[model samples]
Target: MFGNTLYVEKIQHALEQSNFPATPDNLYDPVRYMLSLSGKRIRPLLVLLGADLFNIENIDDALPASLAIEYFHNFSLVHDDIMDNAPLRRGKEAVHKKWNESVAILSGDALLVKAYEQLAFVKVEYIPELLRIFSQLAIEVCEGQQYDMDFESIDSITGDQYIEMIRLKTSVLLGGALEMGAIIANATLVDRKHINNFGVNLGIAFQLQDDILDVYGDPSTFGKQIAGDIIANKKTILYILLKSKLEQEDTQEFEDLLTNKAITSDEKITRMKNLYQKYHVVQEAGELKGKYTHLAYESLQKVNVTEPQKKELYSLADNLMRRTQ
Candidate 1:
């Protein structure tokens, strides 16, 4: 089985070797630039890990599908950055901030096309199923983004609703990546489904941790601006839990604080963190994350692979759930 380091190096090399046309520099350069940025590459790693569980020798067969997932992810980020009007991605200027919005849009569209082009490299026998999974995941991610936007305008959302939104917006792609790898390796339907479930559960836990860390993590280690979600008044799990525990008067006060644009971000973050601490919302969010993470491990245990073969994935999931960045 390939270690995480080997898989990371392999995916990095493949991405570096990816062929893009030289003409239409405006359209392609942003795609190239976005790909060039440093990211955790967790989705592709999940694909490779999923294949390795089946003891597949020619792991290279999974590369195209893995790259397809990666390209699609970057495509979403480019467009999302434009929509969020975010100034930075991965601690550097976002594609839209670095270039004009029109160029970012065109490049992002080109990336979606490129993702399909990468998928073409998969063996013909597996192409149909892989495409089906990829297409379905793509649509679900869009729906998730839409739900996120809709929640921004709505007055309230339940915790269950928030979980569903994250599952669609974030978890399905992780699940699909694992299933695609299983398809490439000719794994049984049962094993494939189990692996997909594992990825989905883990993805949710990861996102929940992200919500917790937004307010609690050290800015120096987080690599991006701290309290960005708080600054924007984005409804994270912490906010949802805190609101659920507060009285109507307190919840109204929280809303007033969120809407008071005159207050500095530091002030808002301080006030919100105080409320979160007062209500033990951070501790509650941690418990929720632990629940999903435990579920993920249970799903992993259902895979048919031997215990020894599962070590790498266990290590990866453990690290992911504990990450601060």
Candidate 2:
């Protein structure tokens, strides 16, 4: 987190050293401005930490690829906001809302290109492997976004499909991120594979936790309304799974609650959520999330890294799984 001095300092140092200009007058100004907004920087830090975990002395050798991952992530968010018609991001106006969808989309595309530009800086010895993994992740993220869009239009979607969608959209990048770190350090194939597995499994748990928080987290901590997902009728795991739990009459009642042509904002929030609670859906979601978290730890333990190094990763994984956001 930015609260940590090393994490904050290294990222700041990386941004400062970047060839990207400082003046707000340039077309790329927004890129710098967006980066300056000071995110958690967890993804890049994961890269640094994972590399260091292998006792690699030259952390800088891997930093460019690490930053490329972060840039690609923000790029996805920019386009995603437009697709979702979301008004805010990180407690501020979304890029699409602040400017226009056209500008937001173009800016997002620029970020995507810049991610590869940064990747060019990664050491040549590792670039080929990095590109192979990174390209797969990039394509899968787009596929995941498409799947999410498909869910909105389709009436029937399996829980398996939902998991696959999020795995691609959200989890694969984290896996590639750690994998990139291992590649830069030239870690053993087994260690690299294990670390990547850790990242992917943790990512699944992270998104599931996000779904739970959307329906139940404290607003003060969440920075958004609890139950916002329910109001939108988003096909979260809780919603899809509980549809099977309800009896015929209860299913009809639930459908009626969501089928309103124009649902009253308050009623939408209340009815969908209370019904979720009635079905104990959040509890079931937690069970699924915990399973993934345990699997992440299991994979992490297989890595041949030192205990002290693994300890930090374990701590980070615990925080991520427990975080309300």
1-325, model 2: which lDDT tens digit per residue? 1223575477678876767655433346656656666688888777877787787778778789878888898899889989999887887788888777777877788889989888789878888888898898899999999999988888777767888989998998898888888888889889989999899999998989999898788888887776877777788998887786777768776887778767786877787777778888888889989989999999999999768777778888988877654
Clashes of each: 0, 0
Model 1 C-alpha RMSD vs. true structure (Å) is 1.7
Report the lDDT tens digits of candidate 1 across residue range 1-325: 6798999898999999987888788888888899999998988887898888888779999999999999999999999999989898888899999998999999999999989988889989999988888999999999999999898888778888999999999999999998898999999999998999999999999999999888888888865579898887789999888888887668766987788888888888899888889899999989989999999999999999899999998998988887754
> Which model scores highest in lDDT?
1
Q: Quote model 2's TM-score.
A: 0.92
Backbone clash total for model 1 is 0
**Which residue runs of candidate 2 sit more than 4 Å off their true CA positions?**
1-4, 21-26, 261-270
